[model samples]
Target: MKIDKDRFNNFIHSYTKDELFYRSLYNAEREHPETFSQYVDTLDRNFIEQHQLYVPSLHDSWFPYISENEFFQTYSQNIYIAKHNRYSPEYLHKHEFYEFFYVYSGTCINTIQGKKQTCRAGDLCIIPPETKHSIAVFDDSVIINVMIKSSTFHGTFFELFTNNNALSHFFSHTLYEKTENNYLLFHTQSDTVIRSLIEDIYIEYYGHKKYSDSLLDSYLMTFWVILLRHHENHLESFLNTTHQNLALPDILNYFQANFMDITLSSAAEHFGFSVPHFSKLVKDHTGKTFVQIIRNIRLEKACRALKTTNLSISSICEIIGYLNPEHFNRIFKETFHMTPSEYRKKHTNL
Candidate 1:
């Protein structure tokens, strides 16, 4: 199952069946507007896949919200990667899985939450689950999509980017919360190492050797590490298509590192923002007040400890910033609808 480099290159260079059909259809619709309806009605049944046809609506064509179960089979692995369809103008649609879209070549229009971004070569966009987005490539362009199942994402990859840094904090929050309109972009067009690694990933995925699965995971891990290590300066985060959060990641990282003792005034001073402006920024970017964010971080740590460690509830509370046992118990029960001991027992048995 060894694929030569030249062969793999040729395979990707050739247009797929759906891509050719879409290109022809697009050309016909533009050139022969009067006969387009008749041409569409008389389309050759076998020219395109039945499930891949684009349906025109009263106002516009749309793609439906796709669920993970429908896209990934039960027996398949958690990760899926493929080349995006060329010449296809995908409409606004949400999916119940994470997608990493890498612009391999040329430029494509990426619309996220109704705002458009022209993604050029080597622009990597990380789209979280439940985010409404669309990608349109009218001309020659190549986009690689690396899709991860939502469950797998939470279980395995969640900790990969939780380090004490601005970029890591961005991923930690984006992945943990599954925010609707958040995405991370990396500009790595000049990085030859990442480009080669992506090619290797593609080869491993398509060649399908016996140990390709494990190798793919290693390659992906290396990919992430390389980006975090070498490409930190090239990173950007977007709350929506237009609004960029340049400093929010570092701010969130500061909060996470000092969740036990940080106060609003101290945080504002550290970030060099006035108290009210800092407070407003926190609310606007995170949709959570400072207290709420701290509580959430502490509670999250407590839940992890309850599930994995043999610590007593009091010790757990102390470690996660709770001073009073009664207060910890009340808050834990309020959040999980059960006492810490009960919650621990439930997760332990499962």
Candidate 2:
């Protein structure tokens, strides 16, 4: 079936009200009970509906320096960039699409979810879908952004990338690993090579040469592969030298249990290592610091609270283990740039 651009646009816009589409799908299924499975398939085939769910707005509480639609258009892969004057409570919010950010210039403290790290030029950060994050630009910063729809993977290639044990394991576990909360930045010693890759992709996407779509796809897939490979190599080297077996389940379980009381030292203690060693382990394994991991956990909790609960900002902060209202406000604003009250007011379903 041919992709309907208009329908796609409608689906994208309707994502903010996903219940309406799901209800319609349910009605359609009820009408065609015998083909209910087929009805669901039709949504995917007709509207690419499997991936149509909206990622909540990243900056609903703050004035966006860039338009969401315009940002999506520039990259042609659903990405955008913006410069901010102050620290945002979070870094980037994602839906089902994977997002990449390259710091072009300026110094910033980025808190992805909750952990804080500082970022400067040549630092690249990737956020997978459904993650909550925020950033505080210490100075005005230019960020190169890219977003890729998970469903964009199709056919045999999709299976190869999605179903492959190693790749799937990485995606399931460490794809969204934090670098730093405030700006735990990676220094790009070879800035030229990374910049070249970014420019090449951008040129192919915008230049629109013959077969550019296919070329862009190839470049994107290669880019992802290279990125994943880099992380995998780092993890391997870390494990081989440290002789520490950091399993995914252990890490996840640790977060789930200790997320409320999560601290850098606590995380280090959980793994039975010194704080510095634990910090290095996290950076090596996931390219993020201990603080970032904890913040990610907190931001996720905050997102869930914002989405589902009717808790007051103070209550929500308490629930998420942030006792200092001012600190929570600072962090929340850095990630989202909006006060929690403002975010809840805007996003709350009436």
Top-lDDT candidate index: 1
lDDT tens digits by residue: candidate 1, 219-239: 888898887788788878875
Question: TM-scores of all models?
Answer: 0.65, 0.38
Tens-digit lDDT track for model 2 on 1-350?
12233343232223223444544554565577787765555554434335333212211343223344444444444233222323223335434445566675665665555556676777776555445565554323545566654323321123235333344444434343432222112345345656566656655555545555456566767765665555433221110112234564455456656778877788778778898887776677765666766776676567546644777878888988998989988988887678877766654433
Number of clashing residue pairs, candidate 2: 38
TM-score attained by model 1: 0.65
CA lDDT, every prediction? 0.75, 0.52
Question: After best superposition, candidate 2 residue 87: deviation in angstroms?
Answer: 8.6
For model 1, give the 10-residue run with minimal summed lDDT: 55-64
What's the C-alpha lDDT at position 21 in model 1? 74
Task: Score candidate 1 by lDDT.
Answer: 0.75
